[model samples]
Target: MEGLALDTIIAKAGARPAAALACASTHLRAAVAEDAVWRSFCARDLGLDAPLDPEDRPLPSFKVGKRLREDRTLTNYMDAYKVWSESFGMYPLPLVKRVKLFWSSLKGWISENFPEALRTLSKGASEAQIRSAEDDLGFKLPMPTKLLYRFCNGQLPFSRNHFEDVRMAPLGIIGGYVFYDHSVNVHLSSLEQMVEETKEFNLDLEEQGLPIGPNLALVASSWYHPKTFILNCSSGDLYVGTANLSAGEMMPCVPKSLIKPTDSDMPQDGLLLWLEEHLRRLQNGMIKIRPLKTSRYICLYPEASPLCSSAVTNGVKVRASAVFAPEHPYGGHPGTYLYSYSIRLSVPEACMLGGVYFSSCQLHSRHWIIRCKDTVVSDVNGEGVIGKFPLLLPGQDEFVYESCTPLNGSSGSVEGSFTFVPGRVTQPEGKPFNVTVAPFPLQVPDYIF
Candidate 1:
């Protein structure tokens, strides 16, 4: 029995029958043992193209697939995969694959970096649960978002009262940044939470005499932080709550063009695109997990170059980056957009400027030229940043400070220089010289958290 002959027999008789035949005949067993034969069985039976586990790690042999059927634990995993794939069958195969990949990647990252947070992930929501949420919200969710929930229902439940407690609040999957007292860690809402939050928001709007729409749902948010993401089921757009949320104002999270339906016969939405792009950024190292006081969250601030600016002047190294702070309504100013920026300055080695060798530098004052597109908006001249003079000495840790700026427009750039004295502010070693703060964009991102 040749391999091709065995494949033909297996295709006709199926795996169980073929296995029985292999047990009876040595030649047939030899042919059935071929990797290709079991590989075909894996695809036909398990819908797996490669000999790999759920985490995408390789399996020893394709024939190990038979165990997945008999083992109860593995059976549950396979059943979930089948159910999820079947649920989104109307979508393009590539898209279904992409969605699975995103969850797998996210889980892998969380397991390695923050395993405790991994426990927070709930199992996939059932069809009945999803339908219940849809009925409660009085609208159907988009196909992409439906498929998303089918993979994982969202994070675990938490009491509203304990959401702000540092010891109790679970680390959010969509990590946030910290600058002083402000904190934001965003998490996806489960089907139950979605209905509740949406209803609560609608009630608030009604109390304020604002119109309530049936198509809206609260999909994600940062507890104790003002940031909230709302989904418009009819339009397939996801929006971030603006300062005027009570007045029914919002900003689109995904570009309109990117949220259209694909050839998969399924409509793509902002939630799906936003998450995929976010995953891409995480996997590519554009952003990273950051530690807070007693916990950690995913920091939105871009750490890579271009998005993050770095420059060295007279041996004074400065690095700066910024993140959109939608939660910060900026003193109730509806038109203004808020962004938090972090600036780090260090003097790792001694420097010489204008024939003066100095071992250290002390921040004196600062100048910032803020622009929106080509037009200058604010030229700020201030004393010490955040009111403290940072002394930079060789081999010492970098002096870091985070401050925010408001933008009237959606896009802008910040570029300026810092005046530094060669020694401590109390005792100057040389005349003050300028250190550059390289230009970095303060523009809105396509994927809003």
Candidate 2:
């Protein structure tokens, strides 16, 4: 037969049959070993555009080099890739590819901006490790979650043993917000970490005489903060622990409808979906990285327009936004909701208020009108903010401060104005005037980041 005819025949016969036929004759072996023939087979079977393994290593031949799934080299680190790739064989190819794309996108962003944080990501865990966790926890992990770890194990927990270590704490991929003494930065837990935390969580519940469900597993938590995320391994839903968690109450992080698979034959889980949605927000600039203290971390607060409100009055501009802090849910008050708002004030140019040119301004006081629905809840006047009066300089960096409040209901709005003098608070250059702080919405997000 012609070479083209022979290559086509071997391709259709599949890898095993072609390998067997290749041994029959030298010509048959040459045709079967052709790179073009094997490449087509690899693409058909594995959805691969290039000949690479799970670790992204180049393969020798598509016929014998069937990625890490069948390559099976038994090293401590490579074993995890083998097991993960094998487990992924059962899922639909499209879903498997999508799961990879999600992690890749997030990792790409981290590598570009926070390369040190990206280096902290652990290698995939072995099947034995995952099984050990399941044995210890007494529950099987959801398939989607299993694949998630298979791509990359959870981030390594930072050691905040010294003052300098405090800088690394905010490197968590699932970052959080800060309000006063309350600080949170959430990161995914490794299988080993999950086993230990779940055990400890159940123990605490047992001590308090609270019911401990066999299906609940602590999968993610803040590095040093009290916040934690729990996964129901059986049902595949994810939740964040609230301030009332010791009393056995938590809030769902993902929407219920999203947890359900579009096809009944295929199974879905919340942790996977949650991370995918988070990546979407990051790429869309809904939530972004912001500086906190001395380090920069992913801030859950919205940065774009609408969700964040901005206005200018008297040549002084104020931009403000709020984020729902689920970890501090209700602040021990079951009926209340907690929100953290960040206010940034700046004078982009020289202040030209009241036809008088001024070089700077100092904040004197603040007036806030908080509302739940349409009813006014709290009207207050206070001196300075967080006990500091920030001075705004012409063409200088904005002065930013974050504070929180507890609302009586789910939905509310905060509108306020700040009193500022044209110069130092001690030496006034002009009469104090109000700077507009536009109203911003406060509501529980449908999809919690």
Candidate 3:
């Protein structure tokens, strides 16, 4: 037994069938999932491998089926490899194309949502000034992403949705153009910085005299910065979406959907397919659904969903959520006081809290959306800026439109039930909904940088 051959040891292990196979030849054991084993370094890798020396490369394809195939050791193990990407969140993620488009739209979405980043960059953007930023971040900027940044920085014609139309239009000016003020500060700086730094770095490329743009555009991320999201423009399709963050989570998330897991429902690999389908169904138009049979469902808002009901995708099913307040439909907070309008949201159940942020504390037993806002009691009236409004749409059925209250962060923090109403829904018996509520709603927060 001490001098036994490898296969002989395997035979003995089969005969003994003991618990100590850990000490035995673990490698000789039959593959639990043979296809998965092959998939780790399959045909795709062979055809399109990164530039590696002939000596460093793996064996190319051999005939199958009729061949008496000899077993070969796996160079890369897929199961064990997954842990490296754990920081990116859950796995078997959405299509790469979607992720790219998401990043592109993300550049735009963040531009749309957070104009502060654009405004700060726009106030003083010059060719050299942007170059310094590129040195800081370490990547080349593409013409399009740059243009969008300029648009955010108030350099071009773009819509600034953050403030009231009357006020924001004047404030969001760039290059003597009104729409240019719609730029985002962070994105503009990042773009300007990328373009400037790369120009010098690619001096070698100029020496080689090969077309230069591909070097800047071909790679998905910057060498200096954490890879920014790149939109998949293969199909000219784009997604409009937002990123949610937690104390410790990773990106290009593998988890099909984000949820506050409960005692009953838990997260698992099976959920990936569900997420993929949900993204596909909402590539265009809005969708609203309430399930009578299932206690839980997913809400997919892939940035392509429409703003109005007529375009809502009828076949798609998603989770319900609430809204954030500030830029209310009718404008300033004062006018919408004590008033209510149905909120249009990705998942309808979101409501105003933290005054400025949206909180989903009512769902799945944890706080979903929340923000920190300043509060001051008014001498003019008992009215202080109560500071939050949960948005609703008219068709939603699970909850009711109730009075708003300021939370001190304690509901015993259990998953509680509530009713939902459409943004268009009205309470004939109570104060008119339209007169009261106008409300509204990132990814690795830029602070991580």
lDDT of 3 by residue, 336-413 (tens): 311111222233433333232222212111122322132222112121112333433323543322122222221111
- Evaluate all candidate structures by whole-model CA lDDT and list the values in order: 0.78, 0.79, 0.26
Quote the lDDT for 67 in model 1: 49
lDDT tens digits, residues 32-104, model 1? Answer: 6667776776566545687665445565666633444544555322322333345555555555566666787
> What CA RMSD would you report for each candidate?
5.5, 5.3, 19.2
Off by over 4 Å in 1: 1-93, 160-164, 168-170, 179-181, 261-267, 331-335, 348-359, 395-397
Flag clash pairs in model 1. 175-298, 176-298
Displacement of the residue 439 alpha carbon in candidate 2, Å:
1.4
What is the TM-score of each predicted model, taking all chains together?
A: 0.80, 0.84, 0.21
Worst 10 residues of 2 by lDDT: 75-84
**Winner on TM-score (1 vs 2):** 2
Residue 449 error, candidate 1, Å? 2.5
Model 2 clash number: 0
